[model samples]
Target: MSDWLSDQAGYVWLIIAALLAICELLIPGVYLTFIALGAAATGILALVFPELGAIGQFISFAAWSTVAVVVGKRWYGANPVPSADPDLNNRAARMIGQSVTVVEPISGGTGRVRVGDGEWPAEGPDLAAGDKARIVAVRGGVVVVEAVKAIEADLPDQPRDDQTQSKG
Candidate 1:
């Protein structure tokens, strides 16, 4: 068994490396890339230094793999794209200052508001579902609203008209 294992040439290790690299393609992420690089190094070492024993080949593979992973991680870490909020695609962002109707009674800091065609979680003063509220702020995809007094149609339209009528 020892002889069979020792008899295995470096090319076999190199081939294993190539297979690992190909496999990395099917699996996304930085892990596979390191393994592939390690394998390629092993193949090169085997092709050039065929006399290296199995233990030596293994050590080389391990050392190269470790270096690859560390370097790849650092290189990737140095340049990271800012992650975008998944909820930014919603249409609520456009309703920042729009008036919305409360869909559910809000007590303390949580409630629901209907803006245009969509309903969103709201945070603000206590208000009933039928009350009208103006969106004051938006954070973490939650809308903040303040209750608005319902205007009565019976109120006079102009202050000047009331004064003139009183004078007459």
Candidate 2:
């Protein structure tokens, strides 16, 4: 048994690498693949130097695996994957720069504004009903708004005196 184990040193590392790769699939931290790479590297080294001592192999595996995990973490972290919805977590950020109507009068910079089907608490200068305000920012679950100039309605030509007179 001892002689067989000694003759199959390279196989031991290859098996270790295969096991680690499997473990990586079960794990969530995304760390085991680096160790598996190091183990595979050590296995290749063992195949190259059949006369190398077991202690030397163990030390090489330890050092290589540690470096692989550390360096891999650093390199992977340097580049981040761009998410599809980066603002998904920040609900208030989506409301910034939108326009909302004041459903309730704003007194002392506090009021309620209607945006779509939802009414959100707002903070801004005093505004009355039907006032138009532009969302500027969000603070403490409240939408901050600034006054926006209201667009004037288009008017046609003035009617004549007879047209303005009441019908009999």
Give the number of the best model, judged by TM-score. Answer: 2
Model 1, stretches more than 4 Å misplaced? 1-8, 81-100, 105-110, 115-121, 125-142, 146-168
Best-fitting candidate, scored by lDDT: 2
lDDT of 2 by residue, 41-142 (tens): 888888889876799889889988999989998988997778899889987888888888999999998999998799999999999978999999998888
What is candidate 2's local distance difference test score? 0.89
RMSD of each: 7.9, 5.8
- Each prediction's TM-score versus the true structure: 0.58, 0.71
Distance from true location, Cα of 72 in model 2, Å? 1.4
* lDDT comparing candidate 1 with the true structure: 0.81
Give Cα-based local distance difference scores for all models: 0.81, 0.89
Query: Which pairs clash in the backbone of model 1?
Result: none
Off by over 4 Å in 2: 114-119, 130-132, 148-168
lDDT by residue for model 1 (63-165), tens: 9989999998998899875758644766566567788999988988898988887889999999987899999888888998988887878976666765777
